[model samples]
Target: MIRFGVDRLVADPDLLGGAKRVGLVTNDAARMAADPARLARVALREAGVPITRLFGPEHGLNVQSADGVHVDDGIDTMTGLPIISLYGERYCPSPAVMRDLDVVLFDIPNVGARFYTYTWTLYHMMAACTAALVPIIVLDRPNPLGGDLSLAEGPVLDLAVRSFVGEDAIPIRHQLTNGELATLWQREQFAGVRLDVLSCDGWTRAMQWPDLQLPWVPTSPAMPSFESAQLYPGTCLFEATNLSVGRGTDIPFQQIGAPWLDVPAVLSDLARRVPKGVEFSEVTFVTGLAPYAGELCHGIKITVTSASALRPVALGLLLMAAVASTHRLRFQ
Candidate 1:
């Protein structure tokens, strides 16, 4: 029942704004809700939008690359267009990539966490567009985690912890769609670029993805499901440490563990400490990937009982604290 920006754009191809050559910053996850088999690019092209090139974000346009894997630039066999990699070799479009395009369109789905690299990709694109004098259009999608500004979490990034994982002073659980974040960046930083947001209709600050009746699509390897994304704003921090946040495993952010972790003790602590919106269970898993592969580790499989009450940043830090306090030796 909800029409995402792609759907609206297709309904009226004029949204391309009379551009003859266009570049799209997108990934495989961006598909039309009405035609799930067709991607946003295909739909736009069918509707007569002249998309000349593409820009791949963190996971590559295919969305199959491993977490933090370097995606190299290549040609999209399906479209026969050059695909520029923003996650590798460069974090933004080179001036040359911008010169070939008359306009740029962005249509990637976001998991609603500041550390989820795609949001920052938009920031870099905004800066590049500003510098190149190319107007950028963002085909907004729903923030799977909901967009209630009041639910935002912080310990907002400062200069010390900034990196590809996070930057600026953006909060951790920033409850906004990617387009909204783009507008904020333009206002605070890249005001020189002309930014247009084709916002999704029927989406509101109070509605989470589950409420929309749309199928969940994985935009990144780790964020494979709603449950994983539910805990990602916090659990992703485990990657910064020696602990395993279940990557290279089936569950990814849904489960967290380290071989050295004492699951029972950590569980006992989290039982009383974690915030109201979540409930977690003890899980013993062997990751097939990194941090601790082939060896068994014990940790928690977090479940969201009430989305409204969860403070992801608070929950994540508390979980870390619990693990750290219980067994200082394994805490990192």
Candidate 2:
């Protein structure tokens, strides 16, 4: 069984070395190995580590908010600790919030895709910690998509298009764990920042989440499964276009469609350019929130048959070309 960084921290509290009050930047997805139900904050508190303040990233601490919606800062009723929102007006914590903290701990789960916002939240947290002169202890988690460098795909973030989504110059499908990413960021960007990474035990670059025998936790509201994470790096590109990436549907990144699309023609075109490791089936859904909310959308469902054989970034580009060729596709 692979032991998570949280488990390691619980076993050895001395890693922080007498740091009493600590601030944690985490969400519900951050969990310890022993109990899947226990979040990082609760687990840390049970283990005698004082979590004085809580920090929420894009979706808030409980992950109840929708994508791209600004989360408001509030007190965690369960813990009575003040919860700061990083996705709101302030992307980073103010000096007042950082002043009382001896150390900052980060343990959010990332989908291994560059477009996802959690890693960027990490980047912001690192910057804040650097400015405050507070040490950051990153409880590193595994990249659900596996960490094979050879599988990494990119258009490598054209710094001009840098947003909250693509903050760094890393490839679209960056095959590195959060700790490895933090280390790389520290080396390339902030050399003076005090950063400590507690790596997962028994995790290798070749092992995906399925190989670890762990339960699938929703990293975000849309990303509910390992399969979703696999398809995300590719399907997420639809967000930049006029197509609906099935955001309001149960299977968000697993399907893509629009009310304006011609299903038969789109399916036929996609079949001709079918990428390896995946199968597409015609699917229709009506979203209640994002994109085409009340209107029915016609699209295809992506079934990832072989994860190892898939090249999501390349496949995404190919998909875009197919859609554009067959329909009046518009980039937003």
Instruction: Give stretches of model 1 more than 4 Å off.
Output: none
User: What are the RMSD figures for all models against the true structure?
Assistant: 1.3, 1.4
Considering summed lDDT, which 10 consecutive residues are worst modelled in model 2? 323-332
- Residue-wise C-alpha lDDT for candidate 2, range 167-258, written one tens digit per residue: 88999999999899999999998787899999999989899889988899898899888888888999898887888888877898888888
How well does candidate 1 score on lDDT at residue 241?
88
Highest-lDDT candidate: 2
Candidate 1, run of 10 with poorest lDDT: 270-279
